[model samples]
Target: MMGEAARERRQFWWFMLFALLVIGAGIGLRAPWPADEPRFVLVARQMWESGQWLFPHRGSELYSDKPPLYFWLLGASYALVRQWNIAFLLPSLLAALGTLTLTYDFARRSWNHRVGLWAAAAVLFSFQFVYQAKRAQIDPTVVFFITVGVYGIGRHVLLGPNWRWYWLGCFAAGLGVISKGVGFIALLALLPYALMRWRGWNGLSEPAPRGAGKWWLGGASFLLAIALWFVPMLVTALVSGDPEHRAYLNDLLYRQTATRYVSAWHHHAPWWYFIKVILTQWLPFVVFLPWLLGPWRQAWRQRDARVWWPLAWLLLVLLFFSASPGKRDMYILPALPALAWAAASFMPALVQRRGLRWALWVFSMLLGVGLLAVGLAALFGNPGYEARLVAERGLEVGSGALWLWRVLALMGALIVIAGIVCRLRHVLLFTALGVAVTWLGYGFGIAPLLDGESSSRDLMHEAREQAGADTVIGLVNWREQQLLQAVGPVTEFGFKQPEDEQWRRGIAWLQAEPTQRVLLSQDVAMPDCVDRGQIHPLGAANRRSWLLVDAQAVAGCR
Candidate 1:
């Protein structure tokens, strides 16, 4: 049998494989959901169908909230898979895996192999990391590029001076900029190290001065790569003479990056919003954060670049995002690699402190007991939470909900058992495994059930049924957010709600044929008799619906 350290070392590959399987469990199970997924997926779908690689469209209109790299990747994947949900999400998933690989390599380069593996594990089970990794969001993809840039820059500055690595880092930073608005913020992470290097400050003295003119080469590469997208937009705008096109490019360059940071239009939160998210959403790892401070302090005192580089990386990234008014819990995801590396630095040198060990033991036991109680509640509690919620919302659910309750209960039981068993030793490993299992259950069991109720597929099909296949289906006073749920292409007929255009135009388009319908998600007060249209009942699916001169009512009205 292998010794304990050797056995632990050998377990690395298996753990990585397990992490992937857990992350991958629910990628294909649900439809593209609203609030984010469907709109972006539809953009990719439209981009592919039109064969327009440069600009993207949301249905009929040009979409300009973000840059094009994420859509480009998503569109390419979707073109190959021919499936909406799977291809839409694969880019983020692959980006997550890339991020993990980069994180592991970086930690390995900085410390020993075991600490690298642990750093990878730290990222794998992070609450915010896994949450964003499983979805079709652009943050994960952006984070990967950020990680690559950081790794390259860290190597160039901290470990040894390498011009090639510095150039590659700049190239990645350029790609990052095209991927999202503030990707260039990642490059700012180098400022602290650069400042330290210039001053011959602590931890940066003995690496020897950099080779001559190296900085110029790196700066040029970043500028050139970033110009690839901007220059095309400029040329197109000049040739086509579309003012909107020019505005779009200008917004991407400045407004989205600077204006939104200072006065965001959406997701507005205070300066302390990130502080709250860091404490709450960055779970498991956040618990180990205080311990990290000691390592940082030690690094500062000893002038150790290996340790202090990661510390600077984390603080600079965190402060950069915090300065923005447009705050989200996942906005800080690009900083996690730094955080993980910093935390894992302490792991290799951890002493067998009895007091710390005993406290963890007690905490684990208590958590186990609480988890067991929750499992019992899930297994046998009356008025199941899912059922109660469904009933309250005036929604229907199938027997599948029951199965979810049972599976969740079983997962809870397993978590509790693992927690109790590892109470005295390997507490983090046990906790990480439990979190992975819980997330797997969420993906496979809990998510699909929720989606079934939320998706308006049935209502969309019903609209098609009430009207003919060719009838113009217009969403009236309903946000175009879920237009991706339509059985076929539909027009938007609402205004001033951050959704679509006016209703009169849509009514005219529908009345052009005399057998179309306008659907509303909320009830509308209709006159006693509608001469031009009649309300079509959709029961619970829609609040009010009208056929613009219904086929049967058309002749009657005339």
Candidate 2:
């Protein structure tokens, strides 16, 4: 018979394999879609092409919404792979794997190998976790850095007075802050550690030397990581003496960070918004909360420092984000590792309960049934909403739309079968299997089907073709995807410039030569001076209709 150690080693590798397949699927199958992906990838591509790494740009506008760390990773990955399609998504995929590995190792050391495997699996299957991991978003990278910082601090406080680990953790957190301005969320772990030490909690390391020097060392490490980016950025911006560079620097440091947090300008939500996010987005894991609460209370009664430390930090993170009026669903993502660690010990037992198993089976069935119903409707019933969706997606009713329905139906059928086959015998595995199928189907099957129009590749291609090979195409009210996917000679009036101004410039450019230059613009941005009858339809993309206008479309107005 195999020993326990050997069995755990086998399980760890299997879990990793599963994670790799789920997160890394469909990487090169699609172009960057809008809302954020195209913007980041464009900035990275410009950095690689223009040799400008200090400041990121989006079609002539200085991109100041985020720091350069994530873009650097994207550019670095592109340098290695030499494929923008793969490079843009590679960082998130690697970061997600790094996060899962960290979660598994930390759980194994703190509790047992079994708990470690379950914790990693739980995180892997979480809807929000895997969804973001598959995208080119900055959150996955930030989450990885924050997890490292937490792991380091937890090693020092709960496992030992290891100063080096604490410093390492702080430094990782600093990297996280530069990634998204939330890296210091890792150091919040120390607050709960101090309280636990005061109460003489069990399972804590022996107290370290009573000197301020040790504490200052960790601070220095954090600052050093921040300085790697900040000092260079500040020095370059000051030395350049460019007004745009100075504005970018000031906006990032002041408005984007502290001012944005204190008075969030967008995505405003109530205090209870994150509560809703936790219950829904953290699914399968959140499903076990009722069972976990009792075990957590018992652990607290026993003064288990391991359990208390993570839970306390989780609470602090929730409060910290909830206190900010401008709340986004992903803002609370950094705390997920702490929550997974606290819940890992109990997952092994919670999976055995009949109530939890039944709940999971029902959840799986509902999800599967919903997808199946929608697929059937799209396939046969000709639902109004479905037709409208097809129109908006710029897909014909035949091949493009049919493939999407087929993939959904296939995923739904697979999920239903996986749930039934696993049932009460292995409900958690059912969850994992169901999630895996969903991601694989979406990645390999659905993403490609929608890529042409969703990523604006089709729209840009049509614009280029209609304008002829040698003609210069001008863009108005443009998105990054349009700018990135555009072919041949293309000119953008401005991305961040006013809609009226962009239309004015685009019309002027097109009017300069009636048949030689064409302008592509969002329907909403086309001016009254342009005759709608003369404009050729370029179909819809990114949920907006676009039209190609030439000099003939202009109604004798500048």
lDDT of 1 by residue, 1-558 (tens): 458658755676677677688778897787766556766877887778888767766665667778888888998888789888688779988898888888888887787677888788778867788888888888999899888888888777766667688788888888888888666766776787877776665544356546667878778778777888877867886788777677666766677777887888899888788878877676666666665677778777876767767768777778888887788888888888887887786864552455455544454455445555654664566556645655533244546545555666677677777876776567666766677667887898777766644455555666677666876666655533347677665676433333233444544554566544544333353222333344555543322232333434323322
True-structure lDDT of candidate 1: 0.69
Worst 10 residues of 1 by lDDT: 540-549
lDDT of each: 0.69, 0.89
**Model 2, span 184-263: residue lDDT tens:** 99999989888888888998887743568898899999999999999998999999989999999989999999999999
CA-RMSD of model 2? 1.5
- Runs of candidate 1 with Cα error greater than 4 angstroms are 1-12, 198-212, 348-388, 391-400, 478-481, 493-501, 520-558
**Superposed Cα deviation of residue 448, candidate 2 (Å):** 0.7
User: In candidate 1, which residue pairs clash?
Assistant: none
TM-scores for all candidates: the values are: 0.87, 0.97
Worst 10 residues of 2 by lDDT: 203-212
